[model samples]
Structures are given as structure tokens and as C-alpha cells.
Target: MSLDSISLEAIRKELLDKFKDEKITNIIQTKKYKIIMEVKPNNFLVLNGINKKRDTFYIHISIDPSSMEIYFSESKNTEETISSPFLNLLQNHLIGGKILDIKQPDFDRILHFIIQPYLKFGQTQNQILIIEFMGKHGNMILLKENTMIEGSIKLVDSNINRYREILPGKFYISPPSQNKLNPLNVNRKDFFNIFYSLKDKSLNLWKLIQNNFIGISLQNAKEMVLQANLSLEKDVSNASQADLEMLWTSFNRIINNIKNHIFQPTIFLDPLSEKIKAYSLINSIQFPPCHKRNFKDANSCLESLFTELEKEREILSIQNKLDQILSKNMLKINNKINDYQKKLEEVKNCEKYKINGELIKANLASIKRGDTEIKVINYYSPRQEDITIPLNHKLTALENARLYFKKYKKTKDSWEIILEQLNNNQLKLAQLAEFHKLYKQYSNSLPNLLKIYNDLMKLGLSKKIIVPLKKQEKKKNKLLPAKYISQDGWEIYVGKNNHQNDFLTFKLASGNDIWLHPKNIQGAHVIIKNRGNKQSPPLETLIQAANLAAYFSKAKKENKVLVDYTLKKYVKKPKNAKPGMAIYSQEKSLLIKINLPEIKNMISQNSQGKILSP
Candidate 1:
């Protein structure tokens, strides 16, 4: 969800307190979505309520259209990077500058960070980093005096948005306002006056508040109803005088908190599902099942939430790409198979040509020249019925017989060729079916899915999955798998890609180690390091590994999936087999339902949301 204006106000206050007068020592743009600013300490280094020992400041700008965030953070996950023009522009201007002020303009979800360069006395200049946390429209723009746009990470032209074009040397304008009432500025008198003047008394109180008020979200509107001890579903027009008074009092109480800076930033998480649900300034009393994590500052809250959100979005992006490639290939193969089937049916009648040839040759004496067709007694038939042999008018009877024989021979050859092509097409369709099955099972396992997709493209069996191509190097690269520590303290490894699967199953796993995979399903190969012992894993640990197999296979959506487990020694890679393909022997199978939420929660709580490299 986008941060509402009230939350932005809280963020503004937090950043202003934490970063005022600090010089930006360095700048790092780790990815398109994240930017890091290193700040030098402004005073003696005793960290407590606000200031910390850390020197880095983070601004995460998500490109997602539904939910976007640009908030202060202490750190972010380090990702591979390439040179970016926008990063260079930001570093040239923002580095070695002191943050002078941080403000949210008119309670909008835009943070204007004003800074002055640490230059010679005669050359000092002021600049602004305007972060718009407005979903798909969200962007980071460098400005001179907050109006003239010097540059932006993203360029908005007339084609993208006619309302405002953000470009170099152009005047930057605030997005058009909705003209809703600013909750902090509206007094109790004005608040009551709005409800009293409402022509629709039957409107729900929560809807009315959300529609008429700025900086108030649906959750906050519901909170207001709770504070007033009134049902959110209650009609505002039918409310009693006492109820209206209570509501107005509650509304003022919230507005007063915004005015007095009484912000209690909280991020609500569902522990079971392991999902970050919502955030608010005031402590939420609703959502009992959700784990409410109160933060010392909103920056920390936003950092953790948006970081996880970015990872989830990345996984979704990979899934979408896989879906597109698989769907495209599947549709193409299906059409080819249909056409081949029709050709096979048409050529199935090749025997009729041979029969005509036989009839023409047998009736050669009875048939005359210049005849289009001739009727004769059918000696080849079981009942000896009469038969009509079509004749070429210009050919002699023997020549016509030879022509029919040639036609029969040509169709017979075509029928054999078509049958071979049909067999090859069916084989390809089966391979694609396997790919689709694996894609559905392991869409969440991005690394493995990507590996499989690359393998398909390499074999010329699937369309190329478009990705940013990296410069090739003359080196032998190692593959990494998803690592998790089991509840029994044993290390478990699951392959992310086909290369990783081969590496895990053949190179990393010892003979005595345990191997697991979803039975008759396309999924990641899972291995449990057994310390070279020829013993079975604990039932719980075995189930845990099996769960991974199920969760990462085509059977992920099924109620119960069969998972096969055996000693690593029993798993064998065939010569010239496709990547990730292997055979196993002496395996035991378990039937278990996959609880993805529980599995994900386990991974997060145990592994700290990090997949280890092999």
C-alpha cells in the first residue's frame, strides 16, 4: 500500500530529526529501486533514541504500480549492479552536501530533502531531492530550488503523462490535488460542519471519512469509528446527537496527535502467513491475529517491510516471465500438433490410391482412350462389386494405370514422412507439458525456474526469455541453491536452477546423504547433508525436506503430493540427459499436503529470509 499523507508527516519528522546538518559522505545506487546515502556524524557518537552508530541512509523507490514506497532506511540487501547514468548524476550533485531541511509538502506523500553543498564559500549551492511515493508515478528527481528539474531517475514525457512532464530544465509541478479536507488543518468546528452539511445521510461513516479527508487511509478511517465506539457500517445521517459528538471528538483526537507529533509507527505482520499487511501512525487495536511490531522509528519499519516487498515482487516477476515463455511455447506446439493430426488423417486414405491403381491396371483392356472414367467389375472386392476407375483423357489405358501407381507411391511416401513428423511434434509437446508442470510447482523458486527456462531456450525448444544480458567472462561459475537449517539442526539444500540441481545431486551430496524430490513431478532437487552416515534422517527432518519437495513442485497446489526420498547414492544422472533430469532407485515415498504459508513462515523464522549459496 502507498503511504498515506499522515504517515508521510511522521516520516518527515523522523528524517528531519535524524539527518539534519549531516553531510552526505557518499552515494550508492544498489539497484533501480534502492539508493543509499552515507552520512558523517554531526556530533559525538553516543547513539540512543534517534541517531544510531550507522552512517548509511536508504531510500527505497519501488516501481510497482499498486504499492510503492520511498522511505528512509538503515540498510538494504546488496545486489549486483551495473553503471547507471542517474546514479552518476545523483553522486555528482548530492555527495558532500549537508542536509538542511526535510519536509512533506502540504501533507502529500512527497518528501522534499533540501541540502547545501560543502563547497568554497563563493561556490556553495542548494539543491533538493524530491521523492514522490506515488505508486507507478513514484520517482526521485533532483531539483534546483525545488522547481526547476535538473534531472530525474525516471523521465515522464507528454506521451506517458500529459498532466505533468518531468524532464531536465523543466519546472517540476506537484501532482493535481483531490481537494479533500486536510485532517491536521481542519478544526473540530469544520469537521462537524462537513458531516452536518452532507446531503447523503445514508453514507457509511468510514466511506464518508475516507472520501472527504486527506491523509486518512481506509484503516485509519476504521480506527476513527472504533475510537468513537460506533460501528464503521453505521449510516452517518441516522447517527444520534451523542454519536455525532463522540465521532467529532474522536476525529479531533486523531488530528490532535498529528498536530502534536504523537506518532506511534507500527507494521502489522501475519506470523502464520509471514506477510506484511499494513502500517499506521497510531497503534492499531484491530487485527488480532496480526503481529504488531512497534518500531522506535518509521525508517526501520519501512526498510524491513519494503525490502521484503521488493523480494516478493521480484519472485512474481520471474513467475510471470516463466508463464509467458511456457504459455507461448505450449500454444505453438498445440497448434502444430493439431495441424499434424489433420495431415495424418488426410494421408490415412493412401491405401485408396493403391486400390485405384490396381483397378486401372486390371481393367486396362476393357477401358478405352479419351474416357474420363470407366466402370468395371471389381475382382479385388470380397463380393466382386462394380468399380469406377478415373482415367486421364489424354493418356493410354496402360499409361493411366502407371499414373495411378505413381500417385499411390507418392502418397505412401508422404504418409510415412508425416507420421515421423507427428511423432517428433508429440514428443516436443510432452516436453513442454513437463516444463509447464515444473513451472506451476516451482514458480516461487525463481532461481530454479530461471535456470530451467534458460535450458529450454538453449535447446531451441522454447522462446527466448528476455532478461538483461550480462557480459560473458572466461571462467567456470559455481551454482548456488536455497539453503535452510532444519528444525533438527541439520543443513538442507534445495536447488534453484538446473545447474544447481546437477551440482547438488551429483557433486555436493555424498553417497550416504539423503535425497528427495516430488514423485512424478517437476521440482527442485532437495538434499539433506547426512554427515556421510549411512542412516536415515529423523522423521521430522525427513518430512520437512519432503515438504520442500512438495512446495516446490507441480503438486504445490494439490491437497497432497507424493514425495520420493532415497540415499544420494541411488540417484544417478544419465549420459546426455537434460539438465536437472535424474533417475533414482530404492526410494520411499510419502504422501503429505503442502502448507506453503507454514513452510514460508518456517523459512523466514529459521533462515532469516536469506538463501545461502553453495
Candidate 2:
């Protein structure tokens, strides 16, 4: 909802109440696009309105407790309570006079503020004060009885006529315009008739007001619909009597609400902190509590908050890519390792290499005769000398041995490097897997937290909702669990992930705080605690928090899972560790598949509006 209509209506109602019986004293131009009128009751009603949605321009009305001061401006001057060029003119000329008449140019649709007042000059006779309010097409003129003293004009002279003709002893009239609407006589019924009769049947009430109604804003039109209890898009012609009656009731209700100063303002949520700090006079039904970063801090922070969420999503994308790359590299290294092992086995199984020792011993005698090249000529050596034959011309024995040794060395060295690389790849893949696991846990936890925040806000405790800051405390290794608490003393703490299961159990927890988590699958670490031993909570409360944790975690929808629980003092966060990672000892696990309907019922029965159920 826009605040413009609400503020304007409030000011207008106030003025109408104060000046119901008062007469205008005098009217004068305070400055360009500004005017002031003195009233008999000595009370000035300042009316401020902004035509643009931007905050730069504003219409202001100031009323003094004793002798009211009415001022209006669209300038961005924050120092003075009431300051405007129009107001300045009114103050100067209409301080102690009375209004004579008001005129409207039917052709130009221009409103003129005319006043006759006794002046201090000469004979103390009445002088005319003329001011026009018809946008840029209108002008203001001042006259002394029947004679014009001064006039505001677009041009001083032209090829056809001189502007001085309107300076003195001249009449004033508005210029011509093709389309116009008289604001003074416009009514709600006329608005309905005119808009309903238009060719565009899809036009809603707000659209009609924006396009056809003179001086009526879209915000005001929406407010009117809300007030009348009539759907803005409902066809007026087809509306039943009952609908019309309801519409009238709604309209009256809104009008009454405005008159009685009952307005709910729109709370501005901080995108960075996801907290609300300021409010405007606009009616908004819901407040989105959790906001993201990386958005422009304009009139609304929602856009920026979404941008932050998008960045997180992008991070998730990058993480997935990294995981894929690591997986592919690990697979490639494993394949190479397998190939090297096969090659090494083949070399070891080679007949020549395997029988080389026996062959050398048998040929020892032949080899010692200075016969560098020798070959066995018999199937079985009857005698070493008898089996000897000169070596053929293809290759020498020493050269063959050297070549085999060289091949063995190359294979060994290559295999070693491949094995080492494979081992390193496996380690890296493990680390990547761990990283992906933790990231998923963190991502899952965020939505649950946001849902909790929203639910809390609905209960009107939005101001109390806070984001947990990361903190580290070093002591005698005592456990400190995480949890959320309500104003009425209900508490819930979720763990970072499964790695923190032990920490959530052994440290950071008190004996009194209830522990809740998903049954078996890896999920958030949830702890519901009582700050003191005030009283033991009901079983339903524990179940509700547990169900939420399971729903938000990686667990698929199953009948039941096991959830372990212990005191916060039992759970401990390890040093130099990732978020949501913890250690816990001597913990008891509960096998409870999430019963969403039952848990919801229990939440409704126990906490109702006190705790956020969604």
C-alpha cells in the first residue's frame, strides 16, 4: 500500500474539521506554485501532497495551535516546519484581510483564489488577490478593484498582442484546453459511471482513477476500494445491491479509520541485516524478515535482499562445477593407475626377463671366453663349449640387457608418478566431497531459519528475530550448542550439519534444553533449550522443532528417522573447523520418522500463534 493516500486523507480530514465554519480572510501568492489563504478563525491549515512517487517533492500543510499557519511545498527543504514560495506570498499579502470570491475557468479548468482585503496603502480600500492552480497552463493576477496591478504571464509580448493588456484594467480568463474535469463538482458516482462506460472493460478501480479522475491518485483509489469493501476490478454495472452495500460499508470503514487516525505503517526491512527499523504511513499486511545483501538501498530493500540470495545460489553453482572437475580428474588418475599396474604385471610375466638369471648361468662359460656375442646352438646344452655359437649380427647381449634395464627404469619411474598423482587426486576428491556436503548443509539451514523468522514476524515478534553471529570461545573444552528462543521462553537451536552431531551432543548444551533432530538421515542439529530449569516442555514442542529440522535437511520424506539428543554441555564445536561441524559423545538417538500432520497439529495445540509453525 502507498502512504500518499493515507497521509493526504489524514491532513484533509484535519483541515475540514478545523475550518468547517471559518471564512477565508485573504489569499496571496507565497511563491511559484504556492499560495496561502488567511481564515477568520485565525487557523491556517497547511496541505502537503506529492504527485510524484519519488520522495523529492511534497505538499505540506502547517497549522499553529493558536493562529494556524498553513504552508505547502514540493521542495526538499527539511530544516523548516513550513516553508514554501507559495506560503511566503500568502503570508505577505493575506495577513489581515478577508476573501471576497473564488472563480474557476470552465475552459481551462483552472482554480483561482480571489480575495478582497483592506490595504494599508492610500485610501484603505479593498484590493484583489488572484492566484491560479491549474498546473503549468494557468497564471495568477492581482487587481486593485476594477484595475489590474500585476499579472503572471507566459510571454510579455507577441507578434499579435502585448502581455501588458492584462497588467491593469483588464479581465482574466483561462486558456483553452481539449480535455478537462472539474474537481469541485466531481463525485464518486460520477467516477463509477464514467469509468464503467469506458470501452476498456478490464480497467480496475485504481487504473480508472489514474487515467480519468482529476487530482485523484492511484493510492487514494485503492484506499477507497478497501474502504468500500468492493473489489477494485469488480464491474460496477454488474454489482448486486448486496455488493454495493458491502462496498459502501468498506468505504465508510476506511473513511472512519482515516478520520480516527487508525493507520498501520509499512515497516522498512534492512536488506543487509534482514531487520526492520523504520516505518511509513502505508498499510502492508506482511513483512518479509529475511533479506539478502548486494542490492541497491533505494526506497525498498527487497530487491537487494534477493540479489544476495542470488549470489549464494551462484556460489552453489561454482561449488558444483568444482566438484565435477575434481571427480573427473580423480577418475582419469584412477584409470592411469590401473593401466600402469597392468603394464608392470605384463613386464614381470615376460618369459625372457623372468628366465634371464637361468639363461645367464648356463651361458657363463661361453660368455667368459672373451666371446662378447654368443648364442646357444643346442636344445639342451650337452656341454657349455659344444652349445656355443658366435652371436648373429642383429644385436649384442650387453646392448639388449641395457635396453631392457632402461625400459624397466622408465616403467618404474612412470608408474610411481602415476600412483602418487592418483593418491593426491583421491585425497582432493575427498576434500571436495566434504566441502560439498558442508555447503549443502549450510544452504539447507538458511531456508529453515528464514521460515522461522517469517513465522515469528506473523506473531508480531518480528523485532526480536535476530541472525546468529559466528563466535568462538576457548575454555576447558566445554560444549556450547546453538538454538533459537522466543519472547515467551521457547527455544530452538539447529546444528551446522552431521559433522557437528557430536559437538551438538557433548558441548554447548544445558541439561534442561530439549534436543531435537531428524531420526536417521543427516540433517540439521536442533536444540530446544530452557534458559533455566523453569519447567519441562511438553513432548509435542520437542517433536515440532524436530520435524522442522528434518523437513529442512537432506532427508527425504520418510516415515521415521533417528534423532540423537543430549545436553548442550555435551556438544562441542571442534577448533579449526567448518560451520555446523561439531562433536558429541554419550548421546542418545531417537527413532522418529517425521509425522508432518501430527507435528503441525501438536504445534497448533500447544503454541498456536505464540510460535511460528511454518
Candidate 3:
């Protein structure tokens, strides 16, 4: 869920409490969506401004989006960011400045950080970093003297938006106001006047409240109705005096929390999927009973939630790309098959041409010059049926027969070549179909996805997936696997990509080591270190390794997953096989449900022999 206005207010207060008056030692735009600043006393503050469909609202201070950072994180994927002039200017103007104050304008999901520039013996110059978290309209703009635009991360012109144009040298303007009443500023008389003024019968109680209130969202408005012991579907005219009293009390209670800065940052998780579902500044009592975890502040909650969400989104994005390629290739194959079938139908009458040629030669004397046709008996026909042979009047009879014979030969030869080409294309289509099935079945497995992408690149099937030589070299240099230390101190390694799977299985693992993978499912290749003990891992260790295999597979969200485990000695990599493809024997299957939190806790206890991070 996006951060609502109440949450943004809570976050702005939290930032002021933590970072007020801190010197900005450095400023770097790690990416267009992210900005990193190093502060005095060793603090890294991140301003993530990604404004995409799935990721609509995130304006918080965190480390980076990829890592699980308790404090802050500097991004390691800086090479992906293109250097821009706007970023350079931000770095030059903001570095060595001190944050004087932070403000969230009227709980509008906007933040302005007032910075005092460092100058030698001069009056303080105030600059502002305005962060607007208004869904697709979200942007970060830097302003000088709070009026003139310095630069913006994104520039909007009259072509993009006529209401507001965010460009350099255009006097900065705040977004147009909705003219809704601020819940905190509304008096009891004015609050009641809202419902009294409403004459639209279609406006329900929930809409009435949300439309009148400045910061209340639809969900929050629903919560307000529940708190007031009233139905959200209740019409505004149906509210009794007692109901109005309850509604007024409830509205004040909720708004008072935001006004007084008493935010209890809460995140709701889906128990079945073990993924975060929603977050809010206040507890959501109207929601169904689920796992609710509260954080000390809003930023910490936002960071933790967005980081995990970003991981899932990244996997989904790659899956979508591969799906598109598969769909296009499937269409191409179907069209080719259709065209070839039509060609085959057209060539089915090649023998008729030969018959015409032979009959014309035998009955040449019957044909005269300037004749368009010749009536003759087809000797080649089983019944000696009379046929009208078409004649090329311009050519001699013998030449006309020769022309038919040449046409017959050419059509017969093309049929043979077309049949051969069709067979080859059919074979290719089958291979692609199999890969498409695997891709759909194991969309969440990064290793499987990378292997499929690599195969598509080699086959020239993917038009968008470009594998640069430098990236290939970099991947070769770093073959990091998902490493976890078991309670028995045995190191367990799980492959995250195709090459890592091959390296872990063939080179790093010993013959006696245990290999685990999801049964008949695309997943990571997991290896449990035996250390020449030549014996099976303990049951607990084996289960942990098996769980990793299932957790990293496409079946991660399933209630129960079956994982197959066997000795590495029984596993064999076929010659010229695709990456991460192997056959094995002497395997045992284990059916179990994976508990993500339990596994995460177990892995977090160990600090050594972990290769998941660079």
C-alpha cells in the first residue's frame, strides 16, 4: 500500500527528530529514483522516489532498496544509473549544507527539507528539497530562495500536464489544492456543516467523510465508520443525532493521533503467503484478522516493506518479459505453420501439370496456331477422360509443352524444400514450447529465469534481453550462491543463477555431499556440505536444505512442496545440456511446508560462510 497522508506526516516528524540540524557531508543521486546523502556522525540517508505502477509512494530514508538494512544502505548497483546533469547540480549545491528544518505541507504527502548552505562569512542561504508523493505525479524538486526552481529530478511541461509545469527558471508552484477541509483544522461547527451542506443523495457516509476530510483515505474513512459503529453504506441523510455524535467523536479520535504525532506504524502480513499486504499510520481494526507487526516509526516500516516488495517485483518483471517473448515466438511459429500448410495445398496438383504437358505433346497436330485451347483425351487419366488443355498461343505447341513441364518440375522441387523447412520449424517450435512451459511453471526461480533468458539470447528469440560482454565477464567473476550455515555447523549452498548452479554442483560439491531440489519443479540446486564424512546429513540439516530448495522455487507460495534429495555421486550433468539441467538417481522425496520466518531466523544466527551478499 502507498503511504497515506497521515503516514507521511508521521514520517516527516520522525525525520526531523532523527536528522534535524545534521550537516550534509555528501550528496549522490544513485539513480533517478533514489538519492543518497552522507551526514555528519556517519549517517546515510536515502530518499527513494520511485513512481511506478506497483511502487507508487515511497519517500523515506533507508539504506538501499535491495539489502535488509537496519539503519541505512548505500546502493551497490550504481553502474546501472546514468549520470545526469540534474544529479551533478544537486550534488554541487546540496553537499556541505545543513538541514535546518523539515515540513510536510498540510499533510499533503509532500515534504520540504530546508537546508542552510555553507558559505564563508555570509548570511545563511535557504534551499528546499520538495518531495511530492502524489502517486504518478510524485517528484522531487529543488528550489532556491523557495521561489526560483533550481532543478528537478523530473521535469513536466505544458505538454505533459497543463495544470502544473515543473521546469527550470519557472517560478516554483505548489500543486493545485483539492480545497478539502483539513480534518485537524476543522472546527466542530464546520465539521457538521459538511454533512449538512451535502444534498447529493448518492453520496454515502464513507464518501462524505473522505471527500470532506483532507488527509483521510478511503480505507481510513471506512475505518472511521467502523470506529463510529456505523455502516459505511449508510446514506448521509440517514445519520441520526446519536450517530452524528459517535461519528464526530471517532473522527476527532483518529485525527487527534495525526495532529499530536502519536503514530503507531503498523504493517499487516498475509499469513498464507507470508508477505506484507498493507501498512498504515493507525491500526486497522476493520481489516480481517491477520498478522500485524508494529514498528517504532514510519520510515523503518516503509523501508522493510518496500525492500521485500521490490524483490518480488523484480522477479515478476523478468517473468513478464520472458512471457512476452514466448508469446511472440509462439505466434510466429503458428503463422509459419499456417503459411506452409497453404503452400502444401497449392502444390498438391503438381501431377496435373505433367499430365497436361504429355497430353499436349501427343495431340500437338490437333492444335493450330493462334488456338487458345485443345480438346484431347488425357491418356494419363485412369478413364481416358477428355480434357481441355490450355495453350500459349504465342508459343509453338512443343514450346508450350516444355513450359508446362518446367512449371511442373519447379513446383515439385519447391514442395520438397518447403516440407523440409516445415519439419525444421516444427522442431524449433516444440523446443520453444517446452521452454515456455518451464518459464511459466517456474517464474519465481531466478536461476531458471536466467537460464531461459540465456537460452533465448543464444537462439535470438529475445529482442529486448541484451546480454553485454562486460556483464557476462562480471557474472563470471562473481558466482555467489545462497549460503546458510546449519545448526550442526555444516555449510549449505543454494544456487541463485544457472552458472552458479552448475559450478556448485560440479565443482564445489563433493561426491558424498547431499543434493536437494524441488521434485519435478524448477528450483535452485541446493548442496549440503558433507566435508568427507561420507554419511548423510542429520535429519534437521537435511530438512533445512530441502526447505531452501522449495523456498527458492516457483512453489514457494504453495502450502506444501515436495523436495527430492540424493547423493551428489548419483547426479550427472548431461553433455551439451542446458545450464542448470541435470539428471539424477537414488533420490528420496520429502513433503513439507516451508516457514519463511523460521528459516530466516536460522540463517540470521550465522555470520560466517554466507555468500548472498557481495
Candidate 4:
């Protein structure tokens, strides 16, 4: 469910207090409808904090319908956020600003963030950012202090909502008001009078209170009913005067909590599905049995809630998009390859056409002028025998022979070109397909998935979702090939993706080191170090490295796989080839098979996401 005004009120307070001395350092539009603003302390000396605490945190604003929220996150998700004109406008005006004040006008689902621009030489400007949490009709608008619209995340013209048009230069207007009474501001007699006027005898407190009051959601209403020591099924008309007064007292108690700024933010998760179901600042008796986690504040609660959910969402989203890109492009390449091969086969018959032309020319004069067929002795034939030759009666034998020669020339000229095209397309298809398989193997891994995303882009595919190549590599967490220790004390490494495979083969392994790969199959390039200690690696080490190759390959599931092994010097990367691609000669093939559980044990020695020492 979306957040209600009550939760927004608590969030507004938390953010306002936290931003007392923080200033905006950077702002990024993290998605099509989301914006993240980085906030840092004015004093930067104590900038480092252990664990979840940080000197700098980000405020995430997502106008997305599913998880629309504005909250603080301890870390920024470097996953590619979109760049839009609206995002650019926001950065220009607000990157160097500080939060002057945060207000929730009328306790509605709308928030107004008043920003004070960085102080220049005796000059200052102020801007107000208004964001609404209304589902589907949600909007984020930036306005001048005088309420002129500067820009908006979503533009609502007259056709969509005639009452308000959120266009640039227009007056900024609040959404139409909900005519409900503010329970906090109203006296007890006034609140009771409104409840007494309800005509429906069967109206329950949870639904009816939510319908008639501002800043109260059905979740909040349910809690109010329970806090009153009233049944959720209690009807308005059935309540006596004493019951009404008791309920009013209960309602006043909750209002006092809000006035006193007491909020207990907690998220409830379903024990079975393990997914977050509901979050509450006020406890509810109506909720089913749930596993609950409490937070010190609303921002931390929201961060954990939305971050976990968004990570799952983003992984699935990019995985599906990458699948589509790879599938469509690979199919196109495959079709081109098939056409080239088919044409190559047709062109192989060019020699037959030339032979027929030679036979026709050898007996050109023996053919009658109007004859449709003729028997001729072909000198070039191994058995100098007479052969029947087809004649085009409308043309001379010389003309027919010339036509055959022309056909032979065209096909012969294209054979080599077609074969070369076929080889190139075949190589591209192999690379894309190999990465697609790698994506499935590590779908939950963000760094590897992003690296795969960048690799696919290099292969000449375009799409909106992209992660820059350099972001995947960090100073303290450099990407490396999978490593394993051989039982004989040899160090073996296996490449996980094309870039790492190229690095492992060309940069890390030396000339005398042993190399292994799945023969004729797309898989990891495996290298065994410790070459200086021995002329050849032990049989046990070779077997383990071969199994590692097969495990990280397409043929992993098969009971047995053919693996090629040679000296690292013999395995050469082709000129201008794809990253993982290589050519090798003087290699021996081994039919390798190993226990799956055993190979995984050898790989567990090197955790992929382990932090590197500085």
C-alpha cells in the first residue's frame, strides 16, 4: 500500500531534523521517475562512519506508482539512473541548496520542501519543491518562491486534469482539497458531532473514520479502533454516549502522540512469503500474524523496505531486458549465418556450370541450328565419352556457353566472401550466446550482470539500461577471475566472463603455464600457476582445472565433456576478435567429468564479492 499522510508527517519531521546542518552536494535522477539528492555535513572532517551510519546520506524521491516515496538512504545505488530534461533542471537549481523548511500543507499526501540556495556574494534565492504521493496522478513540481512553476516531473495538461495544469511558467496550485476535518485541530465535541451525523447505522470506525478525517488512513483508522478498546466490527449507531466519550478519549490520545512527535515505525513481513506486507507507525490489531522488525526512525525503515524491494525489481527488469536484446540480436546473426552457408553450398555447384559450358563449346558446330539438345565428347572428362548437353534453341551455342561462363564467374567471386561473412557472424553469435548463459548462472549478482550488460553493448546492441564499464571496477573491489587451490598446492584460476577471460589468458597467465578450456564449447578459460616449480602440472591439478573449465561452461550439466589443454603460449587470441575468443593449435583433448559438489568446494575458496585489501 502507498504511504498515508500520517506517515508522511513523521517522515517530514525526521528529514527536517536530520537536514539541520546538511546541504545538498549532488542530485541524480535514478530512474525515469525517481530522483536522489545527496546530503553531506557542512563540516567534512568526520566523514567516515562504520556500518550503516554515514556522514553523507541520500534522499530518494521516486514518483513511481508502485513504491512512491521520499526517504533517506545510507548508500546510493550506482545502477544506472536515467538522465532526463527534468532531472537536468533539478540539478541546475537545487544542487547547491539547503533545506530551509519542510512542510506538509493541510496534512495531505503532498510535501513542500523549501530550499535556500547556496549563499553567494550578498545574493540568495529560494525554491519550493512539491511532491504528491497520489497514485497514478503523482507529480513532482519545482516552483519559484512566488509559486511559478519552474519544471515538473510529470506534465499534466488540461486534457488530463482541467482544474490544474502543471506547465512551466504557470502558477503552482495545490491539489483539490479533501474536505475532511483535521482531527488534531478539532475539539472533542466537534469530533463527536461529526461522528454522530453519520447516517449509516452499520458504518465501522476503521472505514468511516478514514472517510471523514484528514491525516488518517485505513491502516491508521484500524489502529485507532483497536486503541479505543473497541471491536473492529463496532458500528457507529450501536455506540452509547459513554462508548462515544471513551472513543473520543482514545482518538485524542493518538492525536497527542502526533503532537508530541512519538512514532514507532515498524515493517511487518509475512513469515511464509518472506515479503514485506505492511508498515506502520501506529500498531494495528487487524493485521494477521506477521514477523515484525522495528526501526529507530522512518527513514531507516523505508530504506530497508524499498531498497530490498527495488533491488529485486531492478534485477528482474534488467535481466528480462538483457534477455530480449541478446535473443533478438543472436537470432538475427544466426539467420545471416544460415543464409551465407546456404549461398556457399549453392556456389559450390559453380564448377558444374563451367563444366557444362566447356562441353557445349567443344561440340558447338555439331549442334543443329534449331536443336534443343546435342551429344558431345567432353575432352576434359576422365572417360572421354559422349555426353548430352542442353541447348537454348533461341540462342547460339556460343551465346549459351558465354552465359554459363558468366554464371560461373559471379558464383566463384562470391564464394570466399560469403564464407568469410559466415565465419564472422558465427563468432558474434557464439559470444552473445555465451554471455546470455552467463547471465542465467549469475542473475542475482549485480556487478557481473552489469559487466555482461556492458559487454553486450560493445557487441553493437543498444538499449536504455546501461552501466558504465568503469563503475563495475572499484579501487578496493577489483573484479578478478575465480580462483581455486589445487590439491597439489597449485593455484588455478577460472574466468567468469569474457573480459576476465581475456585478462586471464593474455595478461595473468605466463607462457609456460598450463591452460584448459571446454573443447569446441563456450566456457571459462582456466589457467594453472606454479609452472616454475615443475615442468608439468600434476595429473590431479590438471583434472581439477579441467573440471573447473567444464563447470563454468555450457556443457557443465553433461556427464562428460571434451576439454582442450595446451601451454598458455599456444593459446592465442585472434586479431580483432571478441574478448573471450581465442585460437589454439598443438592442443590435446581430454574427456573430463567430475563430481559437481566437489568442484563447487574447490571454488568456494575465492568468494566473488570479497573486498580486496588496499
Root-mean-square deviation of every model? 6.8, 17.2, 9.6, 6.9
Candidate 3 per-residue C-alpha lDDT over 1-614 given as tens digits, one digit per residue, 9 for 90 to 100:
56567876776777677667777766655445566666653344345854332211212232222321222333322224347777787777777787889887777767788988877568756889887776667777889984789888788999998878899998888988988887878778998888777779577778888887777888898888888999888877788878888988888898888788877777888877767777777767876666877888777776677666765665677778787888888899988988998999999899988988998888888777788898898788789888898888998888889989999999999899989888988988988887787677556655456667777888988656633222333353344576788877778998865766898898888888999999998889999988867567789898888888998888999999999999999999999998788999999999979989877777667675355532
Q: For each candidate, how many residue pairs have backbone atoms clashing (under 3 Å)?
A: 2, 71, 2, 0
Clashing pairs in 3: 63-72, 63-73
lDDT (0-100) at residue 125 of candidate 1?
A: 58
What tens digits encode model 4's per-residue C-alpha lDDT throughout 1-614?
68788788888999999986578989888677888889887754543563343478889988789978778877655656679888888888888888889998888888999998777656656889899888898989999899999999999889988999999999988888788988768788788887778788788877888888887987788788787888888888787788778778878888788877787778888887667788887655556645888888878888788777776676777788788898889889989998998898889888877988888787777766677888877677789888777778888888888878888898888997998899999888887877887778667655666667766777678756474423434331234676677888788888877877898899999988888999889889988985564789889889988988888888999999999999998989889998889999889988987579888676565443121221
* lDDT tens per residue, model 1, 1-614: 67878878877887788889988877776667556677765565555656555456654554445656656656443555545777888888888889999888777778888999768556755999888877777888889874789898889999998999999989998888988887878887888888889998889888888989877888989888888999877988778889988988888888888888887777788777666777777766666635777777777777667767765676677677777777887888789889888998988987777787788887778777899998887776799998777788999888888887888888889888988988988888887787776677556555555655676778686555545222221121233667888888788898855767998898889998999999988888999999748367788989998998888777889999999998999999999998899999999999988878869987778853244555
Q: Between prediction 1 and prediction 3, which has the larger TM-score?
A: 1
TM-score of 3: 0.67
lDDT-based ranking, best first? 4, 1, 3, 2
Cα lDDT over the full model 1: 0.78
Among the numbered candidates, top TM-score falls to 1
What range of 10 consecutive residues in model 3 has the weakest lDDT sum?
A: 54-63
Model 4 TM-score relative to the real fold: 0.68
Rank the models by TM-score, top first.
1, 4, 3, 2
Question: In candidate 1, which residue pairs clash?
Answer: 441-553, 448-496
For model 2, give the 10-residue run with minimal summed lDDT: 468-477
In terms of lDDT, model 4 sits at 0.80
Greater-lDDT candidate between 3 and 4: 4
Model 2, residue 554: distance off in Å is 12
